[model samples]
Target: MAEEELKIEEGGKKGKLMIIIIAAVVIIAGGAAAFFFLGGSDDDMADVQAVEGQAGAAPSASTGSAKSGTALYVAMPRPFVLNVPGAGRDRLVEIKVQLMVRGSDSEELAKSHIPLIEGTLLQVFSSSNADDLVTEAGKIALREQSLRDVQAKMQEIAGADVVEEVLFTGFVMQ
Candidate 1:
């Protein structure tokens, strides 16, 4: 009876030992999981800080670009009117615009090409109907044609490829 009681007590102690070991393992595993998923302290935020610094350094590069635009503005000509085809019957029938243009080639670039661009635009606008001069789609189409016409005219006048883009400073239809 004594030996049997001793064996029973030893079995209880073994069970308690197993419980302790399991609890310790669970605690260690949970701590490791927490560190792996949610404990990223400063390394994650460093990337964002570095990106902000890089973006801050770019303004100096853009500051000089505004000065270059002064010359472009001086060379740009008057606004041209495109009479909408369907506009005769509608309330808003005209696309009035002022163009800001530049050249593609440095040597071929000439401020004098503004007249040629204006002339080409006058012809292009006059040929377009109301449907081609009204609405968002019409506006985009007109802008594209204006760019093409200006570039073509610039090439013809300077005897080389010139004119980059035509910006619409004033775009209104009424």
Candidate 2:
């Protein structure tokens, strides 16, 4: 009987040890899977940089245009608020903008000239009619005009098209 009890105890111990080993392996595998799934990628890093108005690096001098370097977005400090003339009355409008640029140099240039750029954008936005702003085509036209005016101003100041695109991050009219 003593020998049989000892053998049973040994078997139980071995079984418990096997279960513990399997559980440990499963836990380790789960942890590794989570780490891989949640890992950061290059595109995520680029988006973070764009949000912070910083680009990876400067492109070569020969690549003088906005398309030649890494794309980044510089957000304006404040939303533009104005009144637009409507058919019946003036409507209040608010527009938030971000400027897309290429390269670190263009990002820095845009950030430094925020006030001028804001003024130019405000002028362009305020010129829109409330009826026109309500339409998709009108919004596209406004965006294009804003881009042109901003690029022209930046070109005159920085001697290059520092702003590539004018993005309307937010728009509200009432």
Candidate 3:
């Protein structure tokens, strides 16, 4: 009976040891994962701060021309509304666009040409078909076309590609 008691005690000690090891592993893994994800966010925050600092420095560096290696974004004052041809009836489409430029000069240039840009965008939007706007590829194509037109116009006015990209902030079709 005494030998049997000793064996049972040994088995209990082994089971307890296994549970302790497993718990230790789980806790260490959780800590590692937390460290990995949380550490990444700090890096992201640092990157954002660096970019902001650069943007702030850009305007101070140059007045007439934009500083190299900086990005600027300007939003249009109003959305563009147009009627697109549909299967049976006309579909109304509204889009809000933002202009991505390289520097302060580009941003100012874009702002100065807002009216001309809006008119050009309206012409492009009006030419689009209702069915084409529904698909992802169609939306991308439309954006590309708009960007090309805007850049062309900007080149004519500013003698440079003031507008880098046309970003669609909002799009609705009904």
**Candidate 3 or 1, higher lDDT:** 3
Please provide, for model 1 over 102-155, each residue's C-alpha lDDT reduced to its tens digit, 9 standing for 90 to 100.
Answer: 312231244555566667777876776666655678768877887788766655
Q: TM-scores across all candidates? A: 0.46, 0.68, 0.64
Ranking by TM-score: 2, 3, 1
Model 2: per-residue Cα lDDT over 1-174, one tens digit each: 999999999999999999999999999999999988999889998897785555325653245567756788999998998999999889999999999988888898899999999989988988899999999999999999999999899878778888889999999999
- Candidate No. with top TM-score: 2
Q: What digit string (tens of lDDT, one per residue) describes model 3 on residues 21-61? A: 99999999999999987676767889987987766644422
How many pairs of residues in model 1 come into backbone collision?
6
Off by over 4 Å in 1: 1-71, 87-109
RMSD of 1: 14.0
Judge candidate 3 at residue 172 and give its lDDT.
94
Please say which candidate is ahead in TM-score: 1 or 2: 2
Q: List the residue pairs that clash in candidate 3.
A: none
Q: What is the lDDT of residue 83 in candidate 3?
A: 85
Candidate 1, pairs of clashing residues: 84-130, 85-129, 85-130, 86-130, 103-163, 104-163
